[model samples]
Target: MADQGVRTDRLGLLLEQFDQAREMAQVRLTGLGDEEYLWEPVADCWSLRRRGEAVTPRAYGPGEWVLDKGAPDIPASEYAEVARQAAGGMPVSKIAEDWSVSVERVGEVLAFTGTPEPDRTPVTTIAWRLAHLHSCFAGQWEWTFGERRRDPRLLVDFTPRAGLALEAFWATIDRWREDVASVTDEQLDTVGFSQYPYGSDPDDPFIAVVAGSGLEFIHHMAEIALLRDLWRARFPGRG
Candidate 1:
């Protein structure tokens, strides 16, 4: 059983931080113009190229062979299976790499309004990244919210890309913010609220997971902001 006062305090703090993080992302992205979205501060940094076309230099990590720039909104399990079957033994590190790449691509797409090419070799594009992010978020949320517990290894399939990539990205963050904000003290201390199987305590309270996600949101928001600034500097006047 959880202590009521403590749980309330923690829940309040988590919700506050979640709101702040979303607000920050909104502020950073709101004024961004098209040209500034793809500015690379330095060489070797990847940008979103024409859709279907792969960004140069950076290779698609292990199991990301086929890239679908279209929005399928497929279930997370199916998406994970595809990656597993296609990208044999895709390591966990590759997931992190893809995350970084996706962040960069989204920055590019937001900064510039270019007609991405279709009907080409599917490369990891911004749309793909957004789909992946959404799946991961939904997976995590399912653990924390629905089952209120976690699997040993949370299996999430990252989609190649979806049509509503940008819209979904924004919606995802928004949903996270709302969900976090809605968590009450009762929810926080409820064991099995977080189904993070990797955690030492799978039955840990939801508050802990919310706390971690809040931290992650802040980190990613900063990354997005930095990318936006880089794009702004590179593009100057073009929107």
Candidate 2:
């Protein structure tokens, strides 16, 4: 009942934005310094902590879990504190560098056309990001197809081909664009399944998930780009 031509038009604009953000992220990361990959644009951001750094337990609500904690119903101060605590002082540069290292591994595995290796530690490495992309894609697909009973699952490949970091990130963006492209007005308003189970309401509807995911992608890309910029500034000749 919420479907309308106006809604479709708005979604089209948002989809274009998603593509641009993805592209910009790749552009920013290219030719960045190896050390720059560990730059933190601000304090309390997530980064690769050295060995012995304290690790806090991630908090999640009871019941289902989503990819990210949804908008906090609590006051802004508490929300910011939680996010700050979650970041734990890791730099954006570290995240990019870690991701780049994983890309190198992906390139080798794919180049040799070798068999996929088992995930010894699934969530700890860049493998998590790759698997996250796949899961997000699968979840979006299930939601679009109206299959609410299925749950999104993540699988990791140890040996990845080169350029995979960009490929995986960009591929998800492309899929989202495609999904939104064919989305009818009626479907836009339909409730969809999200990996973020504890954060979302079952009756909330699909449009929210699609838009929220797009926004999440954009935010991540922006962070990546900022890291790249910081790296370039820190080491002027590297790029």
Summed backbone clashes in each candidate are: 15, 19
User: What stretches of model 2 exceed 4 Å from their correct place?
Assistant: 1-8, 32-153, 156-162, 193-198
**Lowest-scoring 10 consecutive residues by lDDT in candidate 1?**
66-75
Give the total clashing residue pairs for model 1: 15
Candidate 1: where is the Cα deviation over 4 Å? 1-8, 31-135, 146-163, 196-203
TM-score of 1: 0.50
Shift in Å, residue 171, candidate 2: 1.6
- Model 2 C-alpha lDDT per residue in residues 80-197, reported as the tens digit of each score: 3333422665343332232333434333332443343443321222222333454665555554544554544431121133255346555655765776677776766765333343
Global CA lDDT of candidate 1, please? 0.50
Q: Model 1 over residues 31-100: C-alpha lDDT tens digits?
A: 5543344344554444344434554443232233322333222233233433442255544343324333
Question: How close is every model to the real structure, measured as TM-score?
Answer: 0.50, 0.51
Worst 10 residues of 2 by lDDT: 61-70
Cα lDDT listed for each candidate: 0.50, 0.46
Best candidate per lDDT, number? 1
